[model samples]
Target: MSILIALKQQTDFTSTEQRIGHYILAHLNQLPTVLIKDLAAKTYTSHSAIIRLAQKLGFHGFRDFQRALTTEIVTQEQQAATVDANFPFSASDSVTTISQKMASLTINAIQTAQQQLDTTQLAPAADLLARANRIFIFSQGDSQLRARSFQNKLVKINRFALIAEEYADEAWNAANLTSKDCALIISYAGTTKIHQQFVAYFYEHKVPVIVLTGNPQSPLIDQATYHLLTVQDEYNFAKIGTFASQAAFEYVLDSLFAVMYAQDFHNHLQDLQQKQQLIQNGPLTTK
Candidate 1:
C-alpha cells in the first residue's frame, strides 16, 4: 500500500493516532516538514504519540516517516495545474482553451489512476477474465458505456462478453451466471443496493467477481474475488460529467485488454491478420 492510501484507510489507529493521521492527511504538503512536537501540539497529543504512529507505519521514528512521505510527495505531485474535474471549463473559455483543458484533465486522470494501481492484482484479474467460460459486465449509467467499449474490445480478441444489465435484464443475467462465469463490475461509488445483492449472489455461487471502482471504502471491494482500482477525485452527482472517473476507468480497461492480448500475443496477431484479409476480400467487405 502507498503511504497515502494506508493513512486514508487506517482502521486500527487509537484516538490520538487517528487525530494525528487525520491532520497529516489534511495537510500533506506541510506534513513533510512538520516537527513531531509541533504536530503533537496541533493534534493535542504528545511526541510519544507521534512516535508510536510512526512505528505503526513501520518507520523507526517521526523523522523517518517524514523522509518517506517527502519522497512520495516528490514523485506524486504532478496533477494538471488549472484543470478541474468537476467544472473543467467555463462559457468564457475559447474553443481552443476548452479542448486543451480537457486533454490535460484526461492526461492527469490517467496518470493518477496508474499511480493507484496495485500491479500484483492486475495479472490475476486478467487471468480470471481469460479463463472464465463467459464474462459479464455489471454496470449502469455512464459507466456502462465504458463497459460496452470494453465488451467490443473483447469481441475483437474472440472473447465474448455480456453487459448483464442491458435492457434491464440484471436479474435474468444473475440467474444464469454459474461458477464458470466471471463478473466485471465498474462503479465509482460502489454502494448501489442492487449491485451489492448481485455480488452476494455471485459470492454464494462461488463465481469470480472483479470490480473496478474509485471509492476506497466500497464494500464491493471485500466481496470481489479479484479487483482493480481507478481512484479519482470526482463527485457522484455534482460533476459536469463523469470526466475524471471515466478517464480512469478507460485507462484501467485498456490496460486489462492489453494484458489479455499479451497472454496470447502471437496468436492474436495472426487472428488480426486473418480478420483483416477477410474484411478486405470477403463479400461483407465495404471497400
Candidate 2:
C-alpha cells in the first residue's frame, strides 16, 4: 500500500493525529523539510505521537516517511504536467477532433515507452516468472483486468499462477509466500493501498516483487525487484474519462509474454496447446 493509504488503515487518528494527517495531506508537496516538532505543534500533538504516526504509516522514521511522501506528491504533479503538455483541447473541439487528439497523445506515450524500454529489466522479470515456485498476481481497478489477463497467459506456460481475485485474502497468502515465490503487481497510478500492502508484505517476507507501472519514481518502484515503466497520455481535459495510458500497459504485457514464450518456444507452445486441448475436450458441461 502507499504510505498515505497505510496511514489511513493503521493510524488511530486521535483528534490531534487527524489534525496532523489533514495538514500533511494538504501540504504533502512541502513535506521534506517539515519537522516532527513543527508538525506536532501545528497539530497540538506530542512529538512521540507524530513519530508513532510516521512508523504506522510504513516509514522507518520521520525523514524517510517525509521523503516517500514528497516523492509521491512530486510524481503526481509530474503526471499532471505531462497531461497538460500533451492535452491541448478547448471547449470548441468536437468528439471526433478530441478523439483524434487523444490518439496522437497515446501514440506519443507509446513512443516514450519505446525509448525507456530496458532489455536488462526484461530478462530478470522473465526469469522470475519462469523460475518462481509460485506466482501471485495482484492489481485493482482497471489494472485488475490486466492482471487477470497476465495470469491467464502465465497459466498457458503451465506455471503455478494465482490471481489476487482468486486468492482474495492477501494476508493469508502472504504468510505462506517465501523467497521462492514471485509477486507481480500492476498499477497505473502505482499508489493503491491494497497493492501496496501486498508489496510491503512480500518485501518483508523476502518474496520478489515485479512492478509494472507508469511512474518510475513512485513508492511502488521502491518495493519492486524488477520495474517495467509504461507511458500514458494524460492529455484529456475530461478528467472523468479514460485516456490512452491503458494501452501502454497492454503493450507491456504483450511484450513480456512474447519474450517469455521465446525463451523456451517449443516447450511453451506445447504446454499451451495441451492446456487448450484439455479445456476443449475434458470439460464435462457448461454448468
Candidate 3:
C-alpha cells in the first residue's frame, strides 16, 4: 500500500499513530528534513510512537520511512514540473518530438494508474454492478464525457446505465434510485458542490455509490461506497484539458466493465453479437 493508502486505512491505529499519519500526510515535503523527535514533538507524541507507525507502514524505522516519502515527493514534483498543458513542446521542437512527448506522457499515465489502482476494489464493484437493477452515473465536464463512453459500453451488454450531466437530471435520477440501483461518480477534484449534493442524496437513499477520483483526500472518499483512485501526474495545468485524467478514467471504467462482463461472459457476448447481427441485417419492415 502507498503512504496515502496507509493513512486512509488508519482506523486501526492508536490516537498517537493516527495523529502522526495525518501530520506526515499534511507535511509530506518536510519529511526529508524533519527529525523523528521533531515530528513526535509536533504531533505531541513520543519517538517510539513514530517508529511504531513507520514499522506498521512496512518501513524499517522513522528514517527509512522518511527516505521513502522524500523520494515520493521529489518524483511527484519532477513529473508535475515536466508536464506542459499548452503546447507540450518548445518552438525549436519538431512535430516528431511533440508526438513522442505526448505518447510518453500518456503511456506513463496509464502505467502509473495500473500500479496505483487497487485490484481488490474491482471485484466488489463488479459484483455490485452485476446485481444492480440500474446504474446511475454522475459527473461533470470531461469526466462526464468519459462516463458517457462507459455508459455506451454497458448498453452493449444490455445493462441499464444513466449518465446525468445536469444537476437537475442527476438529482432526479438519484432521487428515483432504489436499493437495487448503483451510482458511479467521476470527478478529478472530488470537491464539486453539485457532485457532493447528489452523492449525499444517494447516501441517504441507501444507494451504493462508486467514485473514481484523482484526489485521495477528497470529500467523496467518505461518501462513496467504493472509491477508485487515479493519479493525473502527467498534467501541469489540469484544468486546461483532461488528457491524463480522461485516460485514467477510461482505463478504470474498462477494468470495471471487464469484470462485470466476465460474470456472465458467454451470455453477454452472445447477446451483443445478436444485436450486432440485427443492426447489420437492417430494421424489420411491415409485412
Candidate 4:
C-alpha cells in the first residue's frame, strides 16, 4: 500500500492522529520535507503525538514516515513533469489559453506514466500475454473503448482475445478460466466494485490478472499478477471529470500495443501480413 493510503486506513485513531492523517493526505508532496515539530504545531498537538501517529501507521519513526512520503511525492512529481514535456504548446498571446493548458496537462500526464512504469513488472506481463491460451480485457464506460482497441490489436497477431464489455456475460464465462488464460482489468481509479469483483473471482480461480490503472495502491493491485501504471492530472473537481486520466489510458494502451508487437517482431509481422491478405482477397465489399 502507498504511504498516503496507509495513513487513510487508520481513521479510528485519536483526533490528533486523524488531523495528521488529513494533513498528510492533503499535502503528500510537502510531507517529506516537513518537520514533525512543524506538523505538530500545525495540528495543535505535541511532537510526540505526531511520532505516535507515525508509529501507529507502521512507520519506525517520523523520519522514516517522512522518507516514504517524500519518495512517493518525488516519483509522482517526476512522472507529471515527464508527461508534460512530450506535449507541444505555444506561448503566443493569440493562442487560446484553454488549448495550451490542456496540451500541457496531457504532456504532464504522459510524463507521469513514463516515470511510474516498472520494467520488471512489464516483462512478466508481456510474457503472460505472449503465452496465454486466452486473453480477456475488462473495462467499462470510457475505458471500454481502450479495451476494445487492445483486443483488436491482440487479434491482429491471432491472439485469442476478447473484450469483456462486448458481451455482458463475458466475466461469468471467464470464471472457468485457468492459469493458462489471462485477464487484463483496466480502470483509472481502480476502485470500481464491478471490476474488483471480477478480479477477485479470477484471483480465487487461479487465473492470472493484469491490472492497468492509475492507482497503484488500490485493492485491485493486490489481486493483480502484474500492474501497469498511468498518471494523469485530475485535480479539477468539476467539468469533464476523469477526462485527463482517460486520455492517459489511451496513451498507455498505445504503448502497450507497441511493446507487445516489438516483443514478438517476427510473429507479429507474419500474422499481420497473413491477416491482411486473407481479408483483402476473401472479402467482397460494395464500396
- Measured by TM-score, the strongest candidate is 1
Which tens-of-lDDT digit does each residue in 48-100 have in candidate 3? 99989889877999889888777766766665566553345667978999788
Q: What is the Cα root-mean-square deviation between model 4 and the actual structure?
A: 7.2
Which residue pairs in candidate 1 collide?
A: none
> What's model 2's TM-score?
0.59
TM-score of each: 0.84, 0.59, 0.75, 0.65
- Which of candidates 2 and 4 reaches a greater TM-score? 4
For model 1, residues 68-173, the per-residue Cα lDDT tens digits are 8887666556563557788999999999999999998899888778877766778889989999999999999999999999999998889999999998999999
| lDDT by residue (tens digit), candidate 2, 210-270 | 9998765567878789988764544323454444566677768877888888999998878
Judging by TM-score, tell me the better candidate of 1 and 4.
1
Weakest lDDT window of 10 consecutive positions for candidate 1: 73-82
Model 2 residue runs over 4 Å out of place are 1-99, 165-168, 233-238, 272-287
* lDDT to native, each model: 0.87, 0.71, 0.79, 0.74
Better of 2 and 3 by lDDT: 3
| RMSD, one per candidate, in order | 3.6, 11.5, 4.8, 7.2
Show where candidate 4 strays beyond 4 Å: 1-95, 235-237, 277-287
Question: What C-alpha lDDT, on a 0 to 100 scale, does residue 97 get in candidate 1?
Answer: 97
Candidate 4 per-residue lDDT over residues 76-178, each given as its tens digit: 6665654333333345634676566666667666655665566667778888888898888888877888787777777666676778667687657567578
Error of 4 at 68 (Å): 15
TM-score of 1: 0.84
Full-model lDDT, candidate 3: 0.79
